[model samples]
Target: MPALVLAAAQTAPLAGDLSTNLARHLDFIALAARHGVTLLQFPELSLTGYELALARNCAVTLDDARLIPLAEAAQRHAMTIVAGAPLRLGDDTLRLAALIFGPDGAIGHYAKQYLHPGEDTVFLPGEAGLTLTLDDDARTRAALAICADTGHPEHPAAAKRSGAAVYSAGMLLSVNGYAADTQQLQGYAREHRMAVLLANYGAPSSGWQCAGGSALWDENGEHIAHAPANGEALLIAERRADGWHGRSISLD
Candidate 1:
């Protein structure tokens, strides 16, 4: 089998501006395509920033017209793209969600199962986990996670139980919590025996100064790639026959 290539995008999202951020996401997708990335992950609420008050208005459904371009890009690049946004199931039901665009133009979504403090004010916890089979290989399953979900040990544990080979998280981490949060992700990789990927914001979001150290870890918990703490970059990790190889591409 060929190597499985994945990328974690560290970006600076414009607060409450879905149009601008959507364009940025498309640009990043094109860039990742150029580098042969098969899967691309972005930070939490990347499409509309982390503004809780604006989530209700920005919530998107699967058939939203705005998502057509993303679906097209995913098909064009033959990549699976995971982008974060506020998802609305009903008038009062909104969840922090990861919108998944498959290479075949199919759209799937994963809501955050765990909630951080203060998030309950506007969002509901997700009920189920999502695992995606990659490259038509059932052995290559990638589990999706969002902010606060990684903080719960049982979350990744459940993913492992579901036979996921990779545990990928999208987050909006602050500078003060970066060290501990990333350390925990590394620990999850070590404990679960699954490769891990983290995509975090590179700039301020919802009044928090984000710490952008997007990273990837191998199945054995070895560091594969890590982005700088305060820049826009693509942290790419590839699982080859030899092992996991990685590189970082600066977008700034």
Candidate 2:
């Protein structure tokens, strides 16, 4: 298969501001397109800034008209964009989910399988695991994960079992928790023999001091690229003939 260029974005989303966030996402999409990124991922609850109190009111269904602009951008760039949002399940149930918009349109949705400290009160856990094919050869399968999901050993194990070669996680990690979470993510990459991509917040939101540090790791568990913990940036990784090479691009 050909080399795949992937980008993980670290951003500061305004609380409860969906339109502004969507516009920000579009800007990121345009930048990714300029860099020839095949896939782009954003942090958990990026659209609503992790405001659990507003989750229900902010939840969006798959058919929501607000997503039309994202769909059009995906089609225009021929790229796959994975963004986080509070998703409405049935009539009243809400889940923390990664919404994927591809060149073909809305391709897949992965609800967070694990919840953080107080998230259980507002979000329901997902039942099924999700893996998306990134290339026509079907050799590059990517798995979706949320903040707390990276803390569980079984989650990545299940994704590996499902034939995932890349593991992507979207998170909101505090300054004090970044070290531990990064160690755990590196361990997952080594144990599963899969490339890992992580997206995190760059500013305080929802009453928490966030640590950005968006990063990418090779299959051997080597740190390929990392953004700083205090700024908006994009970590890009490309799988090449030699191995995976990565770099961090400033979004500011």
Candidate 3:
């Protein structure tokens, strides 16, 4: 298998500002393109800033016209972009979802299957895990999970059972909660023998002081790369013949 370059982005999206947030996403896509990143993942609710109260109004469908720019960017750069947003399922239901856009177009979505206690009030949990084949070689299969989903051992276990070689999560971990959260992520990588990637918020949003340490772990559970907790950053990891090589780029 050829080397696969992936990035985990730490960003601060403006609350309820879809246009501004999408513009910010475009900027990140452009940056990732320059670095030869094939896959780029953003923090949970990155489009709408993790504001539950505004989620209903901000919710969008997979075909929402507002996402055209992102699709075009992905196609132009030959990159796959995974961005989080509240998704409207029906007239009255919404799910916290990660929208996947590839070089062709919108590919698929992963709705949060396990919700945090606070999330239950605003979003519905999905029933299945989402997995995607990253390339034609079919050697890189990635599974998606949301914030609280990573806390459950069964979630990653199920992903492993489904043939996923990589486990990726989009989350908004608070400053004080990052240590425990990251420890669990490393454990998942070690136990499941799957490469792990995490994207998180870089600045305060929805009244929480977010921890900006987006990171990646190798299959052996070694920390490959990690962004700083103080500013917007991108952690990139490339799988090589020897192992995974990684670096962090400051975006602030």
Candidate 2, residue 87: lDDT: 94
State, as a TM-score between 0 and 1, how close model 3 is to the true structure: 0.97
lDDT of 3 by residue, 59-110 (tens): 9988899998998998898888899999987576999999999878765688
For candidate 2, the lDDT comes to 0.90
**TM-score of every candidate relative to the true structure:** 0.97, 0.97, 0.97
Residue 66 lDDT, candidate 1, scale 0-100: 93
Number of backbone clashes in candidate 2: 0
Per-residue alpha-carbon lDDT of candidate 1 for residues 1-252, written as tens digits (9 for 90 to 100): 468999999999888898999999998898999989888999999999999989989889988999999999999999999999999885659889999999999998999998877789889999999998877757688999998999889999999999999999999899999999988999999999999999999888888989998999988889888998887888888888999988888885
* Runs in model 1 lying further than 4 Å from the true structure: none
Tens digits of per-residue lDDT, candidate 2, 2-62, equal 7999899898999989999999999889988998888899999998898999988888988
Cα error, residue 66 of model 1, in Å, equals 0.5
